[model samples]
Target: MSLDNLPDGLLLEILLHLPLQSVFQCKCLSNRWCSLISTPYFTHRYVSHLHTNLQPFTLLFECKDDQSITRVLATNSDEPELKSLAAYVHRQSEHLWLEASCNDLLLWRSKDDGESSPMSVYYVINPITRQCMALPPITLPYHRSWIQAGQFRVYIVSSNTREWSESKVLCQEGFELTHFALCAVPYKSLLFWCSNSGRLLGIDPYNTRCCRSFEQPIGWELDKETDCFGVCRGYLRICQISMFYTRFSSILRIWELKDYDNEGGGKWYLEHEVSVNQLVSKKSPWLNEHVQQKYPLPLVLAFHPNDGDILYLAIELKVLLCNLRSKTVEVFCDIPHDPDTWNDKCNIINFVLPSWPTPIPFAPLQNGA
Candidate 1:
């Protein structure tokens, strides 16, 4: 019997073993295959299979310049599909800005011109499915500016609705919500923003009223530049570097949020602590050259999604992978620009591509009526 004559159950089983890109190509063979691959059941099963087999995910570094050109670097440059996805997004629009990235969805913003304005359009895209949904335009209040006082508005788009909604978050009386909007971190069902004062603001997109602020982790200093926050191994984690002013020694501490909804706001447990100088000297001496300088401290770019002990660090223009357990460091890749240039215009995003395409939740009436 031919492959086309195979039963649906058997065909699905075979397709699940193929690579993600191959499965995408299989969809174009016929409408029947496309429908089968697009079903929720197929996606669920395929994702489970990928997890069981330990499919590796890629990391993307995005740098934006003055001309609105975004430069993306992927850890796994050998993968054609990953490179194509990055190229596709840039090709779509030169002025496109990547706002935030969740599990399988990427939130993008496009301005009407080269300058900032209130009339900005947002889009939610799934690279795997090659689908895009453009949200309704947003108009801010005329009186208040983007960072006026201690108030900021968050625009939210839900899978159930075709239109976008807004939520206002009030900060502490004296604190200003500066730079936090550009570095919003999406984890689980809530979005988290860390202020320069080391305070954390979390909000649930589904319910705008459920917003809360948590104190900074113990030992973290306010207005310090040696800290970074990210999610690792299914937990929210933060990495902080403390230096000894007298000596050239610095200690790196990793903290994990054990409980966030407790009465004390949240509880953080010290996960890992290691000496930066010793770790670098033992394995990679090149990185230790810059450790003595107090001005340019090593920056933590991201943590390994599957392994909590592995970390990605930027020492200057080069990115290195350090394993805490083995006390070893290796250069992962070198970036063309300075890593310290990451600011409002430049960003480093950690993207993990899901095995199966997530269905775009566009409302039925969005296409018409």
Candidate 2:
């Protein structure tokens, strides 16, 4: 019997198991396949299956000098494996800046060879599907001014419709944009940014009117210079950097958002506090004895989606898994660092996840046809 004669149910099951790239390529084989693959029903079912077996991991983007590479490392409970994503996603002549990710969709801005600008090219892609769509230039009010004023906006590009939709504009008093530190949690339709004053600003992509703000948790002195913000499993995380001015001792405070079911209904709670002083002293007792020795601690990367007690931290050269409940820190994975560019001072490491419920497909216009 010919493959085309297969039942619709059986064909769908086969398509679901195929790599996303194969499914997309099959669309060009015939109209029947295109219509079948592009249907909302099939996309929903396929995405649901993707979510059911999602493998949450830590993503790190490393830029050594002018060259860059992306590494996707395993999280706690997973084997120590690192996959270079740039080899699969980036081109030889294109330099891409990852912006955010949602629904298995990754957003990025690309600059051509020798191009110098703040991302005039934007894209939304699903690496699993091996599909990508370019987004039109975003429309915003005073775009550059907003970036300079410490106010900014988040926008979502719909692949189904091939149009740009405004998420929200975050303009809060005393919230100055910390350039190179803004991160988005697309699963929750939220954008998180840490201000220069140790305050965190979270914006609901669904709501464009205003954003919600929270001061740094009490009892912790935030350095504002090194604190980091991130979200995992829909919980907002703030890693505060504290140092004893007189001594070289340092401390890290991890805070999470509790009761964040709605746009503005969550409150910040102190989750775990890691003693950098003890950590460093444990590593080398003689180093701590010298009061002038300063250790640059790590930043919180993301919390494990399935485990509440597990979180990842990115130190200078490695990512560590801190089991808050167990109070034990173990090596999750080691990131590659080039000694040549180690002192370049412009490198930043962050994560981009493949979330569920991929971008909604564009609905055909009824009157046009």
Quick one: best lDDT, which candidate?
Answer: 1
lDDT, candidate 1, equals 0.70
Give candidates' CA RMSD values in order. Answer: 4.2, 7.0
Q: Among all windows of ten consecutive residues in candidate 2, which has the lowest summed lDDT?
A: 360-369
Give per-residue CA lDDT, model 1, range 30-81, as digits (tens): 9989999989899889888877643355555666665556555647446555
lDDT at residue 50 of model 1 (Cα atoms): 75
State, as a TM-score between 0 and 1, how close model 1 is to the true structure: 0.84
TM-score of each: 0.84, 0.67
